[model samples]
Target: MGKAKYLSAVEQGMVVGARRTGLSVSRTATLLCFSCSTFYQELPHKLTEQDRQLLKCVLHKNHLSSVTTLTTEYQTASGSNVSTKTVRRELHEMGFHGRAATHKTKITMHCPNSLLEW
Candidate 1:
């Protein structure tokens, strides 16, 4: 199978329309790089635009904060006791996740005596 893909509303509508026009489900899904199961499954409640904006602000203010802290901050900002998992998921969807630069040591090349002769 190909990599997972998230389709937009228009793309999903096209899929449904394509299926109605006698296109094979697998073929249509493969063309769009989408999974058939996800196409048919109903998604749960998604964060609204306002909620996402608030979350973004909170995240920016606490860039190094943990998921639990973010969740609490979001709740205080938006007056909703959202779950930590939900906050984490929204953060991931918004392209925010834990990542740190790897530490590296400087490298030095040893000079060859034979090559040093002028």
Candidate 2:
């Protein structure tokens, strides 16, 4: 219900460097343009146990294609509502990206020259 707790990569690196330079948590947070309390609150990622289990299920399943489909399947199986944006953002955080799938390639490529090189 609070503002989403997100720090950019630069901010995260700066936070680490601030600690290394012996900046107090309060000063460091101030330098980063946010309150010390917010810094502490946002510092540790609080992935709930339920979210972890659901995310694990999502990552391990190959049948899933898009976040739209993923959210639908998750809601059906878990009886809960999770947004496509939440799934998409979390997927990005979890090191997964979405790209349009092209049907140009078959299961096997017919490049004999490339196959011979392999």
lDDT of 1 by residue, 1-118 (tens): 7555667789878887888889887888788787777675534456898999999999999999998998988899899878998898888888998998999998999889988895
**In model 1, where is the ten-residue run with the lowest total lDDT?**
37-46
Please give each candidate's TM-score.
Answer: 0.54, 0.42
Cα lDDT of model 1 overall? 0.83
- Candidate 2: worst-modelled 10 consecutive residues by lDDT: 40-49
- Please list all clashing residue pairs in model 1, or write none if there are none: none
Tell me the tens digit of each residue's lDDT in model 2 across 1-117: 677667778888889899899999988988888777666655654345587578759767944576788877767777767787776766777777866787784677568786789
Provide backbone clash counts, one per model. Answer: 0, 0
